[model samples]
Target: MHLFADMLARVHAAAAAVLGPSADLTRIVVEPPRDPSHGDMATNAAMVLAKDAGQKPRDLAEAIAAKLLADAKVEKVDIAGPGFINLTLKGEVWPDALRTVLEQGKGYGRGTVGAGKKVNVEYVSANPTGPLHVGHGRGAVFGDALASLLVAAGYSVTREYYINDAGAQVDVLARSAFLRYREALGEDIGEIPEGLYPGDYLKECGAELAADYGDRLKAMPEAEWLPIVRLRATDMMMAEIRNDLARLRIVPEVFFSERSLIEGELPDPFSKEPPKPLVDVVAETIAALREAGHVYEGRLPPPKSGNLEDWEDREQTLFRSTEFGDDVDRPLLKSDGSYTYFATDIAYHKSKFDRGFADMIDVWGADHGGYVKRMQAAVKAVSGGKGQLDIKLVQLVRLLRNGEPVKMSKRAGDYITLREVVDEVGKDAVRFDMLYRKNDAVLDFDLAKVIEQSKDNPVFYVQYGHARGKSIFRTAAEQGVLPADPAALQRADLVRLTDSGELSIIRKLALYPRMLEAAALAHEPHRIAFYLYELASEFHAQWTRGGKESPHLRFIIQDDPQTTQARLALVQGIVTVLASGLDLLGVEAPEEMR
Candidate 1:
């Protein structure tokens, strides 16, 4: 149960009672006291609502304090600062929270903060030109973990990938595969010419074309062969990408192709009719914006910092993004009358809105930070302010081995692929290390250190903590201190866990639901990773403390079976929370670590 959320609701109700039901309670927040000496929770209800209510902050606090004094759960209410209400709950409340964790087990930290809202999270939309790289892995791991986090918080989330198959890059991929195809047909294709994909991955596509069509494709003209080859190469590359994503366990619900947005008859491949707009999505988006008065013909200013070598000033189709909080108006088309990347993206996001996603999140590389404002403004213009677009930018990744930088890859010849990293270190290490830091921050993923089974290794430490909890349960069973069945062990007298260390761990366990709620609201899965590390550290600290001079704090006591069972229950609580959190992170919580 969300104890703090419950208390905040009570505090809001008390404020409403004191200052009429019409009082605005939105600004008030009840949070854990920074300095634990103050109280369990402190609220800023009076301070936030005081000026609007036309009363002194302290006086308003006193009035609300009087109303809260009658609550059965509140042992004391201390007023501090201008109007902060510090509340200390009954001591037994902590023990009751421990019981709640025991009873909930796997469901201990499940939260309902999302209220079953539908959210679409699109990530790892890497160009289907090649295998996913380590940078893409960060986004894949992050998006998967974020989706799982939202599910834990009661949101129905759709994980998606926007396939960029219609771009010029895929045409390049087609040309590259054609070279390999010629090699397959005994043409002895020499050195891969510049400006075409040189990766060996497309050789399979070349071989497949040779095996399926034999010389049929080679006999066709460039235009006819190019279409069939581009489609085949893109499909094969996308399949390879899906296989790599499976290594990381990221299965996107939808692979929305960018080429599918243009919904009209294609100009005949044989007919030379100047390619009738092909049901341009970009044109449709511009028309919609024009109808809304957000689109206009305008010229954009030149670059701010770069040399204006090729800068051209001409009136063109533009979206008035400045009206929606963007810094400037954005171009919707290039000089060639084709849709720019921004225009197609606008159509893509609008399609998401069309599919019933009121809330949409796009995980992008840090280089795309400048692209955020325009996209958000476009969503506002398209959805008429009914849709929300949240873009998270993941920064660069630095791959290292031990303390030395590790670079280059045999597969891609330029950089390490995502599958290579996953093969070098297990998926758990790759995913956990990627998320152990914030998305916006640059990450240093050390291969050697990540695999080390030390406390310094956050993933191993947390997994080891789960294994240690299992060890305690096994020890308890062998000593006949508790039953092997978890349901029976949960029947222990938890009131016996009065020690400060035991209560501290129990309090940490109680914070899981609140942590998950906050993480989901903030759209940050790193919070879960960081929380798991701290939880493991606290558990290990208590265990080491017990080994030192605190024998009474030991989880297993030979003479006192009841106390042992109670401590074993706490161990089970730790294991349940760790496993649940690890499961959310797509990390394995091993019963025993080797």
Candidate 2:
């Protein structure tokens, strides 16, 4: 029962009837009045549709007001300056909305904005080189929460992780692992090379190689043993990555390998044959773009950065991305006649479109901001303007402890690992703190501040709100004032809840469904975090007012059980909404704080 949605529908219907059924009512919206003293809700329908109605804004507002005043829920309709319509719903409407919240429980705020559209969300595509760092944690938490939010809004989403296995970095990883292999065989390897990875986590991979084939890999040539070592090291590293992600409760449905796009084969899922010929997707993608006149051999001007020393003036295969709104045309091949990174990226996204997904989202680090336009252009050219690609760039995190920068991990050798952060403080604190700010802004994560059991910490404050609600039920049942069963509590008389503070809590709870839909459409999970904090703050304030302002406003009254039961019903609504909103952000709602 979304109150604003219902009222907006009625306004649209009335506007259509008065404007001859052909009016553009999409712009008409029902929202809370900017100033609470004005009214409960306000609409701009009259102002937006007055031109088509061929009447003054106030005249149309009066006619629409007349139609709305007849509604049972709307108690009063007032016309303000220049065609603004303000609606004040009946007092009973608030109680009925609370009853709906109790009836739905955890399913209270679920919406239907997505309508079952298939969306592919690819995130945390960190290379299988080593352990994940704090920067990777931000993107992982953002993408995972965004996927949960879309599902709550009725979108069929697939969580994916793109494995960057085929690149020069993995070669460097292989060389680094080989040194550890020599050390594992009881050889004197004093120091790691300057260009290779120095993380001590690779020692386990080298030890495994030694245990499986003792002195066997030492005799083989570098070319022969490189592939064998690369496979084993990559498998071991990916296993470690999975374990790390599991600690944070993040499990991606698909782990698509980047190497598969170029070297491996993809079978046509729609083919009649069991196993068709191995298709070279990258080559086929380039040929298709060539046929469509989007690909050609041309020389790009020197880069705008003025670093022309490394620039080559010779003609190379290029993609005409400037025609599709990119800054300039992009190259598809390097000087050595090999496919560029952008070329393979285009083919990978085309594969997502081929698999029946028209909406795709990629979550990348802040450093990848310059790559968004080119990728979007490629999606437009490859999908024939039918597919949509949205790229979200997550900024880096500054790890701190008591206002001091935390030192880097010895195991990772350069930066702090995500595993270490989760191990120190539980998953809930890490996740909520990461999403407490916008994805595009710089976040300062303080280890000491997040674990404080005080109002300054948002995670603790919100979880305490849930615990406080449960505490009221426990205290009430102890005094034999009311039953703890939700079914029995739902039958409580809600009309007794007439306090302005109590109604304020109900109004906040009623806005959850609308906030969730807007956040999902905008691809921002921080909105959910912010909404939960505000609701918790309001509930806490109302609880304090009960003790300081009036005794009759208290939740549990020993002499009268009816008012106590009614207040408990309000608590039920508060806890239900708080739990649902916390779950969407991948945070836990605890039953008790201590």
> In TM-score terms, which candidate is top?
1
Model 1: residue 298 alpha-carbon error in angstroms? 2.6
Q: Work out the TM-score per prediction.
A: 0.95, 0.94
Clashing pairs in 2: none
Candidate 2 TM-score, C-alpha based: 0.94
Candidate 1 collision pairs: none
Expressed as tens digits, the lDDT of each residue in 416-487 for candidate 1 is 888899998989999999999999999999989999989899999999999999888777777777685778
lDDT of 1: 0.88
lDDT of 1 at 62: 97
| Runs with alpha carbons beyond 4 Å of true place in candidate 2 | 47-62, 78-84, 265-279
